[model samples]
Each structure stands twice: as C-alpha cells, then as structure tokens.
Target: MTITTTLEPVTGPFVWRGDELSRTDDWIFRLGPDQVAELEEVGRRFIADDPDLRTVSAAQYPLTAAAEAIRRFGADMDSGRGFVLIRGLRMEEYDDTLAAAIFYLIGLHLGEPIRQNELGDLIDHIVGVSDKAYEEGGLPSRTRDKLPYHSDSSDAVALMCLRPPASGGLSSLVSGATVFNELLARRPDLAPLLLEPWHYDWRRQDPDAPADTYTSPIVSWTQGCFSMYAGADMIESAHRYPGVPPLTGPQREALALIEEITYSDGVALDMDFQPGDIQWLLNYAALHSRTEFVNGADFAHTRHLLRLWLRRDVGRPLVENFGKHVVVDRSSTRTEDAVRDTQGHFRIREAAAVRTDWGD
Candidate 1:
C-alpha cells in the first residue's frame, strides 16, 4: 500500500495535549547525572543483595520511591510526549535471569506493580517464549528480534536493554496523534474510517482453542481522548475467520497513509540503543518500531532485551471497540490457536512454564 498524503515537518518537542499532540518541553524529561548514578547503584545492589537474582521471580522494591520517579518523569498517557528512550544502560553485564529481574524492579518503580506470575503470563502471551526455550534461547523471538511497530496490552510499555544488537538495530517511534492530525488536515473524508473497528488476527494462540480473530479500532476517540492499534499483518489476518468484515478501500488508504506519515521524518524519531538503556512509552499514544538486526555469532554476544507491559492506574479509557481482551484482573490468560511453521530463519520451540531457580 502507498500513502499519498503530503505532510508537514515535525517541529518543537512532542507533547500530548489532551487527545491532541503538540511540541513542548513540559512533557519531556531526562535523568540527570546524579539520578542516573543512583539508578545504576540501585540496580547493582538489587542484583548483589539477591545473589539468586537470576533464579528469583518476584517483585521486591520500595513502591513509594518508584511511584515518585514515575510521576516526576511524566510517565502517563495524557503526558503526550508518548515515549522516552533512556540510553547508556547495559544488560550484558548480568545473567539473563538477573537482567529480567532488573527490568522488573525498575519497571515496578515506574508504575503500579503487577506480580511476577502475572507478568510471566503476560510475557508468555506477548512473546510466546516458553520456559525451556527461555533456558535455551535465553529470550523469545519477538523480543530477541527487531520487533515491528505494535502496542502491547498496557497503558505504558517499557524495555531494558541488557544486550544490544552487535550492529544495525535501532529503535524507532511515531506519534499516533501526529498521524491522525496529518490525516485530518490532508484527507478529511478518510479520517472517520480510522475511528471504526478493524479485525486483528491473533497469531499467538494455543493449540486446543479454535482459531479466533479479534476486532479493534485502528483509531478511536472517547471522552474527548483518542487511542489506536494499527498493524498491517495483524489487521489482514482478521479476515481469515468467519463473520469478520474485510478492509474497505478507504480504510486501506488510511492505513497506507498512516504508514507513510509514521515512517517519514516529519512524524518519526529514531535512536540507537546502548547497553543499560531503558526505554518506556505510553503505548496508546505512540507507535513504535525497530530495524531488523543481526546478533553476534557467539551465544554470549546475541542481542537481548527485557520487556514489561504496565497498566497505568491513571490512564484514560479505551474506545469501546478497542481493548475487548484487556481484562483488568491479572489472573486472566487467553491463549491463541495460530499454527507455526518452521520455514523462517529463526526457530520457535513450544514448552510449558517452569519454576524459576528464584523461588516466588
């Protein structure tokens, strides 16, 4: 698909103003030298105090301090800059388990903490990396590779870089609001089509359940706020199931326009991640992507990152058609039935969850 919309250059800092977007310094925050040092020290000690850290599978931290940092740094959906990419944090120095633990700790400090078990389930759903594969591969394919632009089940999402790609893996971000604004200005007639629900193919399904597809709006507005979830492959897959509507020509046009706007310099921000860097974003507010990359030949040198999907207690409501599967309780787990073939370069293994060496 091709986008025909002409776009204006993005100026000013990216800021979220209600449901709209603008550029402003108020929404952007950077950690100072002292804070960065404090964070590193805290991370180091957390690993040291819990020597079985790699085996440990629980969230252990002071909630007040973590919440304070999140509030101060503007880590909410309404805060509009939508994303923050922290550089200089390296994950390779620690073991995979410790690396994941560190990510969990820092993420807990950033938002309302969810249990490790719940986190584990969510991770399994998002990445589908089983316990055995985690032991062997060290991480899942979705995370180990350059993840495409997609939103996870959260108001805010974060990733801590443990081991970065040896070469050619850069993080990219685009504002959904920016794309909508560009569309509203350039192609007013197609704007409303995006506000309606579109089908999504849930590729990561369990074996027992029937193959099912879900529907969600690519763009939606509620209480004067807007949210979105747009992915080319996922949206196209929805039609495979019975009773789902096909993509309309205008919807296709709008999606193509969105791709153009997001990839263009006018709406996108690109950065190369360094080891130890932590990147977080308001998932509903921003669309993110990564460039394809190659891991080093050695297992020790392979690229790895830890991810967390956080529900912002203070976040806005999802449009009615979106968020159908977003159950509030942490215990809910829905499996998909999409089959996997071994044709790709990478291999995917199916295994059950295992008890971590670190006791809960």
Candidate 2:
C-alpha cells in the first residue's frame, strides 16, 4: 500500500477497550524467515556503508520492499490500530552488537530516535540498572517493578526484547482513547479533570535542565483528534509542588474508575513477549504498563529489552504542554552526543536540545 503523508488529524480513530479486542492478529505482525534475512542484510549494509552513522534515522538503513511494510506498520500507529507486536526473530542467534544494530535499523525505518532520557540515550535497554523502582524517581526503563498505566513521553515507542524472563513479566496495555471515552460514559463530571493541566516532576530527565517540573493535561483535543499525555506517577509526583492543584475528589474518583476498568477482566491485554519480539506503541493513544518478573542470574537467561523512542513526521497537533519532552518543536536546535562502549555497544551520552526535552 502506498502511504501518503498528511498533517490533518484523523477524527476519533477507532477506539476499543480490552473486552472489545482480543485477536493478536488485529495488531501483531510476524516477519517470515526470508524477511528477517533481508532485514539482517539491510543492517549489514547500513554498517558497511558508514560504519559510523549509528542510530541517526531510519532513512539511513535503506530498505527495498520491506520499507513499504515498515511504513505500513508506522501508518497503523496513526491511522489504524495504535499498537503492534512484531514477532519471529531469533535474538539468541545474533550477538549483542548485531542484535542491537538490527533493532536500531528497524527503528530508523519508523522515525528519528529521540533522547529517551536526560542521559540522551537514543536506544535503551529495559532492564533494572538499580534496585529502585520508578515510583521512587528511579528510571522506569531500568526498573523491575510494575509500571503504572501511562503514556510514554514520545510520539511512539518500540521495544525489541533480547531476552525474556522465565515467567510473570507480561506487558499490559490499554487504549487511552478508550479511557477518554469511558470517563465520559461513566461520569462526565470527572472527564474534565483529564483535560486539566497538571504538573509533573521532571524526576531527573535532565540534571542540568532548568525547570523542576512541567505541566500538561491528561487528555488533549486538537485537529479533530484526542491525544493523551498521561503518566500516573508523574501526576502523583506533581503534588510535591505547593502551587499545583491537588486531585479533586471528582478527579480522584475519576482516575479510580479508569484504573479499575483498565485492570478489570477483558479490559486490558497482557502480552507474553518472546525473545526477538518487537512491540511498538503509539504513545499518544496507548497507555502501557509492565508487570514484575523473575530475573535470571546470567545474561543468556536474564530479561533485557532494547527500547526506542521515535518521532515520526505528521504527528497530531498538540497543545503547548504536549511539547514538554518535545522532540520536534518550534524552537529547538538539538544535536546527538553518543559513543560506543569498549564492546562496541552504542551508548548515549548526555544530550542537549532546545525544548524537546524538559527534565534530566
């Protein structure tokens, strides 16, 4: 299918609750062995060409017919379903360098990778770096605990699992649009709270960043589309500010209703991720979470997933607050700072941007 770019918002793109959708086929894409080989060849060529142009953009990794499929995948993130599970790669077959490069190559096909944290990590590993969980200000990307249902600070996010746990670390996702609709259906009174601007503690997304916090509403409506910028932990952290308003009784009750419905049977979909599984989510439309898992002792059996935060062209028009972790904004001159480890694994140094990023 030929994809055409447009800035106009797609009105109320079909929203569905967990009970309403069940088939993995609705969103999952499995790459056949031949396609996998072709992608690997693309990675090899990308490396052979520049050998230094790592993780810059998807266009760097030239694709043949595969480009169309990947573009279709991205198109779905905006115009069709808001999430997709691409399975069927044998991660263990490849070493870390090749595996990571391949994942980054796929990400480049989607969009330019943005700084994931103040650390400026373009690609991140989703395994605990410390014992602390995100609730205590530890980075969620490096936590082993449960992540609350929240939209990530990006236009889209991709996770390619290098290794999965033995059991109990299923990824859970709920439609943010569904949450928006549910708030109105159950209690219109609380629905307005979602549109209320709320501050979130930057929590060290940047160490040298100027502000301690930034504000945005949970839900935004613009260009005939409803976009969500929500993170329960961030909203709860906002209470530390004296000026920030507390969640009113109606807001609290409203949030409770949404969460209740989310975890309820048939309302949320939990995924059993396999090694080499790539999960892509449109951050604006999907509220995602992760459950706790038992980690193995060694690298082979341990849980590790590479994460990418990409910003595609033609994103929905958003409000001012929407640009907090702004990747592409009106005033921004950003340059990436990156280097590889002794093992040749790519690492993101601290980054600098105009305003796409607010915290360290």
Candidate 3:
C-alpha cells in the first residue's frame, strides 16, 4: 500500500513560550474536574488492589485499570496535534511505589492495556531500555539530554510528569502526516523516497545483535492509515553499510523540508510539563523532541516524569520488519532484556557524570 501525505494548510501555527503552548479551542481531548478526580481515585485503588504493583521500575506495576481506560477512551480521543495533556492530577506526595503505580494506571487508562512483557518487547525493539530498569528509567529527570523526533515501538506514547525542570527541558512536537502533506503539495517528486525502506542504526541495541542495522520505511500504509519513522541520525547511519546506497539529493531535501516545517510555527507545539499532568500522543503520526535541562540542587527535588508505549486495539496493522520483538502476527512476547539489552554503549564514569551541568 502506498502511503500518501495529506498536507492541509494549518489554520494557525502553534506558538511556544516557556512551558506553555498556546491554548486552542480545538483540543482533541480535555479531562473535566470529575474525570480527573475519578482517574485519581482509580489510581489509588489500583495501588491498593495490587500490593505487588509498586516499585521504582516502570515495568513493576499491574496495568489492568489503566489498560481498560485506554480501551474505553482511545478511539474517542483526538488525533490532531495528535496529542493530549491533562493538567492537575496530583500524586506527588506519594512514595515511589505509589507514584509508579499511578503512572502505570494513567498509561493503562490512555493506552491499550498490554502486559509489561509486551511493553518490554516494544522497548527492546525501539528505545532498547531493559525490563529490569524500566520502572526507574520510565520517570523523567532533569538532565542535558537530546531526543530527536522519532516514534516509539508502539501505536501511542504517553508521559506523566511528576516534576518540571528548574530551567530548559521543554517538550516539542510536530505532525509527520502534516509534513508529508505539505511536501506532497509542494514537491510531489520527493514523496516516493519517503515511502521506500531505509535503514536505522539500532544504536540502543545490545552488542549481541550483530554490528548490523534494521530497515523500514519512513512512511507506511497498512489498513488505510499512514504511519512514519523518521530520524536523520538513524537514516544517515544506514549509508555506512556496503550494499546500501546513500540517500538521494531529493530524499535529503525532503527530510530537510520536513524538518523545517516541524521546527516552524505552522506545525510545532511546545510546552513545559507540570506535576500531575499527563501527555499522550500518537507515536507514528507525530515527531517529539526535548531540550536539554539543568538539575535542581538536591536529588529529591530533580525533575522527573513517567513514560509508556502502548498498542491501541483499533489502530493500523504493523508493516513487515517493523515490529522485530513480536511477530507481525502479534501472538508472541518476551521480556525486554531477553529480547535485547537496554544499556547504551556510553556509561557515566563518576557520580557527577550523571549531572546536567554542561551546555547543549
């Protein structure tokens, strides 16, 4: 199936200033006070119902209620901006265990409720985070980090902020579909290259997977819906292989064009996250980015957030070679560590190595 970009002119450009994006009357989803209270109550019960669910790890929680919430609300949720951020749903005073539980519950509510093992499988294929550290690393922390716009290994990705940065670390987003549409309208010749398969470095992969790379297209069409996976770093790495040809001038130009649109006012959105606020987005439909941030003076006061990748029940089909951990059939699963190692090649040499004091 050929995926086409559906570029429609933006009614208005998204403006970002500090931690807040401009408010729109056309939000895809907004939680009322009643809904927020209900969600909190559900979170409290979720912890109480499963004593074994709390831990520092993202994978430790039982996600029954949270999954049910996604199953109930995901389809009704808006896809444009292709995201939602629910502010003011406090759970900060709770212990790490309770906080983790709350994060999992919120994820379950907004996403398809798959087992932690399933989440691990996707992480192994995408972010390469192992199952053991999933819970701890799932939360946000203030640090000089640069994550480009790329899709997670799931239909949707969600993050619940427990704290905001003392400075910097703003979240940015752009719609891949919107970019494609614009390119199609202005540069039709370049569209085909985006739909063709490209290689990715799998930089987060464990050493045992062979010093090779994985391949997939930036744009894919399955079940009549469009999906994308575009990251310039990964795309450039593919050229190192003997058989792979370099990206054509037009292809490179197309990528640059998309990046320009993404960074511009027409398609991008930026916001500072606050405690108790949860942001959920369609992974394939949008590109997400984060700015580097500084840490507070104390460890306990550092910025932190919890994240999850979810497979929506009603979403499009997986293209071949797209989901490496699970069969395209979606019938099997494994622990994230078993499928692949989560540790990156880079390691901190000392305690201060983890500090975010350097310039971006």
TM-score of each: 0.70, 0.83, 0.69
lDDT of 1 by residue, 213-309 (tens): 6667876566545666777655765676778777788878887877777666545666666666677877777777777666677744455555566
For all candidates in order, the CA lDDT equals 0.53, 0.67, 0.52
Put down candidate 2 lDDT per residue, 1-360, tens digits, no spaces. Answer: 121122222235447666656763677887877778888787666555544323355555577757776877787788766888887777767766567677777877787776555434566667754566566666666667787788776788888877887666788888777776666777777776777777776644444334667877887766566777777667677677667778777767866787876777776878888888888888887888989887877766667788778777745777667735544321122444322121222332211111222321
Superposed model 2: Cα runs more than 4 Å off: 1-13, 48-55, 204-209, 326-360
Per-residue lDDT of model 3, residues 12-37, tens digit only: 12212212335553433455556556
| Candidate 3 lDDT score at position 35 | 57
In terms of TM-score, the best-performing candidate is 2
Task: Superpose all Cα atoms of candidate 1 onto the true structure and report the RMSD in Å to 1 decimal.
Answer: 8.9
The lDDT-based order of candidates, best leading, equals 2, 1, 3
State the TM-score for model 2.
Answer: 0.83
Best by lDDT: 2
